[model samples]
Target chain A: MDKVKLGKEQLKELKYFIYSRGFREPEVMMEILDHFACKVEDKLTENPLLSLQDAIKEAHKEFGYNGFYSIKASLDVFTRRRYKRIYWQEVKKILLSPINLLILLLIGLCVYHSMKWAYNNGFYDSYFNRNIVSSLIILIVVCTELIKFIMLPRNNGRSYHISIANTVNYGNFFLFWFFFPSRKLHSVNEILVISIIAVLCSVYYYITTLAHYKMIKAAHKDYDDFKVLVENENPLQ
Target chain B: MEQNQFVKGSLATIILKLLEDNGRMYGYEMTKAVKDITANRMNITEAALYPALHKMVADGVLSATTELVDGRVRKYYSLTKKGKKETANKISALRDALESVQLILTPKIANG
Candidate 1:
């Protein structure tokens, strides 16, 4: 068969090989194969000793399948490293940002003042005041904001999703704090409802974190596979 | 080997040069061309390749078109006017670096 005329079976095999090895771009893979075939055909016309299959095998040997994968892997590393570097740079900028720092300080002062006011008003001692609940609500909001600030630098698909879920969780916690009757909540039924909401929030946080962790793990695996391919293909060249 | 390290930094220059010569190329074709030209000495990673291409597109250094080929969508990248100018600048920069390095390494002898 003509080297230029790559059969469907060969194309399919090449595609599957690339995909199974974790190359995500199908178009790029096809283009590469087509280019390779063309080059081989050109080389064959000049020197007939280089059969199409032989040319392909030689080409493949020159650019080992694993080596190609490694390049992909190294690129992943480069991206992640670049992302991380950019993220930290952004974080440093955010930390140094006067407006952001001022907002955080203002919020901190407001919470502190509110806690002091609650104490002065004897809300902590009285059952009807709900000062403890309000304080808890403020604490949750502050922590949620802090979590968001920390996650902002690392923000990508997984981090973005996590931040959203955290926001929702905080919102639910706020609702439960304001609406749930603390005055009549000495009963078991009230306590059960509060406990369930708490449990639900805890579960949500666990699940979200777990999901993010799993995603990062998968990315790391793909990265490692890519690295292996590069090392195999270009061994100290 | 140190020259190999410069490959990453010079990738944009290399891509621009190739496009200058070839007029246009898709992602895989560009990569294959680089590999062939380098005689497989340098392997361009797909992950690095796409992001760089995308960034160049975003930066207006290159223009892209998506076309259906063999029942799949392929994105072709071609140099814009900005890309051509930038390529010229890169070539000049490379030439200057080569000259400077050669000047520094060349042995100076007393005039006879």
Candidate 2:
């Protein structure tokens, strides 16, 4: 049996079929497309009498009822968990670094003593004002990350779901302000509690920003690999 | 086709061994190679293979390079330095395990 090849239009249609089957990531889409195409061609070549469409259908059936969809689901879960694990590892390393260790020490001392100083100055009500700044900072950081993630060109990488999930989860922030508007501080102790929270928020923001940057870099690397792969396959381009 | 859990247990070594022998191979190529080598007795599903490849890639045991082949982006995976060393270790370990299993499977007379 001679080798049978798919046309450009057929390739596009094959891509659509993969996409419609629930593979949104171009990284996953490309891999599955190659696998599906190869199996279909192999089927056609062996049978010799089967049409291209029939071979494709037969190949899809071979993937079983779940097919690439289950692979996509498994991939999503694995990548998300992997990103989180990487983020936590980096966070641990960052906190253990000499500079960050010192910074955290300073942040702890400063937040505690600052609250005491404000209380000594008769600024008990100022905790609300301090919290407002922290709240707004959180909102701005969330919005900035959301915009960055949204502005990313479509189909960047396989594992960016964690970063995007971070932004999506920020929707809870609005409900927070809506429900906690009356949360007030009446003492230096209360102010100290808020300060600890504020400091933790900042630390979280720092780590997320780092993770997002790493993800973007990863996305670029994977997408670039894919682009080169596509370009290499079609020398006519 | 349903697969033997034994195959799943040895997937990493199998993959590393393949890459070591073949230089580099894409996802489907690896699956077809296994099937062809086993005369279709072994089949690795897409679900099993891709995640394993990604895991190896994530772990820095395998390095993936992509290239276009017939308008398809094929990700070819090859062993890294770490992967090469691990492959040797796994091969030895698998050999020992197989020997033990072989002894278990071999028949002997029931009476002493």
Candidate 3:
């Protein structure tokens, strides 16, 4: 069987046909597009008189009753798993690196000293502590939202890394429950415990922040690579 | 041939073995290679092939890279170090199973 390549116009039409089938992400579309193009080209080669639309329909039919959406659904499952692995790898790096551990300990010590000083300086009232916790929560929520706004739109919502980063950002919500009830410290030991917990949470926050930054950086690289590949394929465009 | 049922359970193993032999392969190319190798006795459908490839990738048994070919991006999958080890294990296991099945189907006659 001879090889037949689809022209630029045919490629564009095929792309629009796939986009119409509800694949919005360019990454997903690219894979599906290549598969569809290969099959349609095969069909056309086998029968030269077959119209491109009919060939496309035949190719689509080959995906069976679930159609191309099955591929997307399966791909999503693997993609989510892959990103979760990446996020855990990031967390492990933060936990395992000696330098990071030292920074975490330093942060813990600073927070502990600051809380102890506050307790001795007559600023340890429950009302004041509650206000501080609330303010911290508010700040974190605002910062998370700001990061999402700044990072997400640029990816065109195509990256699983960005989506996982968004999910990790929302993990900050647990701080409300963890810190809300324990606002007042009854003893120096209590302050110490709270400070330790606070420091750990802050480190977790730092981990996620760093992870989000790396993911967004990776997402940008993915976009850039896609652009370069597309340009190589069609330098004029 | 009705190799679908048999192929379903061993798809990942077959894929691993293929990559072990071929070094790297894209989706359509893998399907074509299987057909050619088996003389069309076995067919790996697109619906099954892509998901299997993606699952191996997620499992860290394979890594994928893309190249622009004929104006479209083609994703080529290659086995990782873990996958190399897995291929050896799977092929050994598959051989043992096939031998067991063959014995069951045509049991050796006992000496009189």
Candidate 4:
């Protein structure tokens, strides 16, 4: 059978149904709208006599007593879970990838030797100086991500994934922040080990920032796709 | 015997294997395909099917692409490379499970 196409008004009504259900996230909205429309059309074909409204009702019922809300719920959980996976994948790449390995080694060696240099020069002799530098570096990394978020356009297709990815940047920030005051700073080994950790904190921040950058790029692509699709569907618009 | 639990448990594998054979399928097409293949004996409800599809997409076991077809934007799902490998694993594991179940469900009269 040829497809029983929906009218523009019917499509608007479908959009209203999806919007009213609180699925305002652009990606989620697009996915759900397309999926629901496909199901609604399937219903209409199975019963040629059924009106669009009737078919929509039947299709919604196929989602069970909970209706499309259940699918939305699944999507919500899946979104968070997916972002978490992305965060770890990006982190693993930075920590283990051969390309990043040399950088990591360089940073580690630099920090280790600098701490030794400072200790011999008496810069590390002051507790206030030691904590102040670590604290400032952590603050700077966190601030940079926040600043980028503020600078991006409001319609950047920002989503939970971006925030999740940024959170990975802060993964080791608290470790150094809280661990600084309690450290046994009497020995060369102790201070050098702490300096290596400082380098790791910076690396962690870099990984998260890059992941967030990729997500933002993807968001722009999605928005562009939606724009082209909309223009194609309604030429006058 | 009816196998609602069996069908439910094997849903991911069933979907993966179907996509492996068919190349690409949409949500409605999948339900109909299942109905046709089983001659209406088994039905994969929308509730079960959509969640599975979305989960597979999230897990990278499947990839979804959208195209305007029949004057409607239909999201099509197909196996990713990971999904193809997973399909093979699931098929073999399911086969092993079915054999184990068959051993208990039936027995030769006297080793014929």
Candidate 5:
């Protein structure tokens, strides 16, 4: 058996392995591999029958792959739980914050005023009261808004997830206006204003969602390249 | 070897114990020590060792220092005070477990 030397290639492979495995500390990983190589070399000196490859493999097996995986899995579970706890804590902070709650209350008041206007003008009684079609449209709009509110961050950051959420939100609004009873005795000016709002929302939604989809695709591509790097380095060993 | 079917639970203890005895060691040295002590009966892969070491550091069970050696900077891990105390507890637990099992399995000798 040829003596196992820690060559440049092996170091590179070890570095890639540690990085791919999500250690985040490449310097520490290299140090560990150096020690592992030295130990394997020492074992080789004692037992000429034991090959370097076999020794390394034996050392790793004693460490136990499944054992390591379980530890990692537990850590992942712990981290996820910690993240959830922290997320809810942040949400609690946001909800409890007087300014945020005041803003939310003001938005609620705006929505209430809009509903009251729709009710007083006989728009709600005429168009929405008797027809299941109008009711369904209202339901769809509400559902879309609820979903958007849940999925999109409150701060209105232009993230891909938020953009997709907004698109669904606007699409529902457009559907609502398109299906609204236009033949009723009402002002065309109000209808036009609402239609314009819907159109603007739809345009923003469309552009943002497209940009978000492109970003999501790019991220996946980068991750795929990282996976390929791991496979190339390890080569089933 | 099969008696120790589950290895993950003992890894932190093993690492802490190794570092407690050795003063300071890197990932590979720790792995090698465990393997050599087990006489090739146990193995730990790079995948397992790095994450455990990283987590240990994160959790304050270990402290690390980095130095450049042989054209590469290597990080070495040493036990914290908490880690040393934890290692003592682990050793006691392991010892108790072994004793209990041995007591249960030992055959009584006939009085001659």
Candidate 6:
């Protein structure tokens, strides 16, 4: 038997039904709608006399007791894991690449030299002077975060995954304030350790910023692709 | 007796095998494929299939893409390179496990 395909209006109704069922996340909704639509189509094929509503109900019944919640939950978990994977992969790639490692070493050297100069100049003897490096780092992070917030993607129907991935956690940077050396530098080892910490922080910020923009760009492309698909299907509607 | 538990244990391997045979498949198609392959004796239910698929995708063992199909956007899952390698290992391991179980089930007879 040939499969009975649903019309656009029927698909819309199915989407609404799923939305009513609380799977509102666009990505999640898309997956659930597709799966639900397939079942409904199967139902229609099995019983051609069935009404769309009845077919929908019958299709929904196949989801069993827990219904779509379990599917949504799983998808949510997958989205988060995928985001984390993308983030860490980029970080690892940047951290491990030979050229990047060389660049990081250069950055560490610059930080060490600057701090050594400040220490030799007796900059750390003053309370305010000791905090200059940490203060500068905190200021740059804050400003970058502010800029990111201001330039957030304007797309309305973005997936929760994108939104969650887009968020920059500032909590990690809070440790910078506490760990920063506040007293006069005692030895070269202290200077070396601080420089390494500074370089690590900078690299962390760099990779996260890179990942943030990458996600936004991908999200925009995804949004455009879906929009085109919808427009193609509803050309004259 | 229905062996949903047995099927559940090997669901990931079963899916990997299916995707290995069929390049790309949607959720409903996978459930149907399992049923057809099992001659309707076993079934892969919705509650079980989606979560497993999503988990595999998360683990980089599978990848999902969406396409417009029959007036709806269908999410199709396929194996990644990692997934392909994993499929081989999983299938071999599962086969070994099944062989061991078969060994246990086949009672030893007195030496004649």
Each candidate's lDDT (Cα)? 0.55, 0.69, 0.75, 0.69, 0.54, 0.77
Better model by lDDT: candidate 3 vs candidate 6 = 6
**Alpha carbon lDDT at A36, candidate 1:** 49
After the best TM-score superposition of candidate 5, give how far the Cα of residue B5 lies from its true spot, in angstroms.
Answer: 1.5
Chain B TM, per prediction: 0.85, 0.91, 0.95, 0.92, 0.81, 0.96
Candidate number with greatest TM-score? 3
Write the residue-wise lDDT of candidate 6 on A46-145 in tens digits: 9999999999998898898988988888876766666667666776777778987787677666666766666656665354556466666767877887
- The collision pairs in model 6 are none
Residue-level lDDT of model 3, residues B1-112, one tens digit each, is 3578799888999999989999999888888889999998898887788888998998889999989887788899999999999999999999999999898999689999
- Every candidate's fraction of true contacts kept comes to 0.06, 0.66, 0.70, 0.47, 0.19, 0.79
Return the top candidate by lDDT. 6
Candidate order by TM-score, highest to lowest? 3, 6, 4, 2, 1, 5
Cα lDDT tens digits, model 3, A121-218, are 64533544543543454467667767676766364535644445445576575674457443555676776666666666767777776666566666
Runs in model 3 with CA error above 4 Å?
A: A124-153, A160-162, A171-185, A232-237
Q: Tell me the tens digit of each residue's lDDT in model 1 across A1-117.
A: 443444545445545544554554532343344434444455566567765556556555645446355444443443445334433444455557787557545545554455445
Per-residue lDDT for B1-112 in model 4, tens only? 2576778899999999899989999877888889899999998876678788879999899998888664456678999999999999999999999999999999768864
Candidates sorted on DockQ, descending: 3, 6, 2, 4, 5, 1
Tell me how each candidate scores on DockQ against the true complex: 0.06, 0.53, 0.74, 0.49, 0.15, 0.71
lDDT of 6 by residue, B1-112 (tens): 2598998899999999999999999999999998888899889988789889989988889998878788667889999999999999999999999999999999989898
Alpha-carbon deviation at A147 in model 1, angstroms: 16
TM-score of each: 0.45, 0.76, 0.87, 0.77, 0.42, 0.83
lDDT of 1 at B97: 87
Docking class for candidate 5: incorrect
i-RMS, each model, one decimal = 8.1, 2.2, 1.2, 2.6, 6.7, 1.3
Segments in model 2 whose C-alpha atoms lie over 4 Å from true places: A20-25, A96-110, A124-159, A166-201, A220-237, B1-3, B109-112
Per-residue CA lDDT of model 2 for A125-215, tens digit only, reads: 3446434444454466668758865775555345444445634334534433443233445676676666666556555555555555555
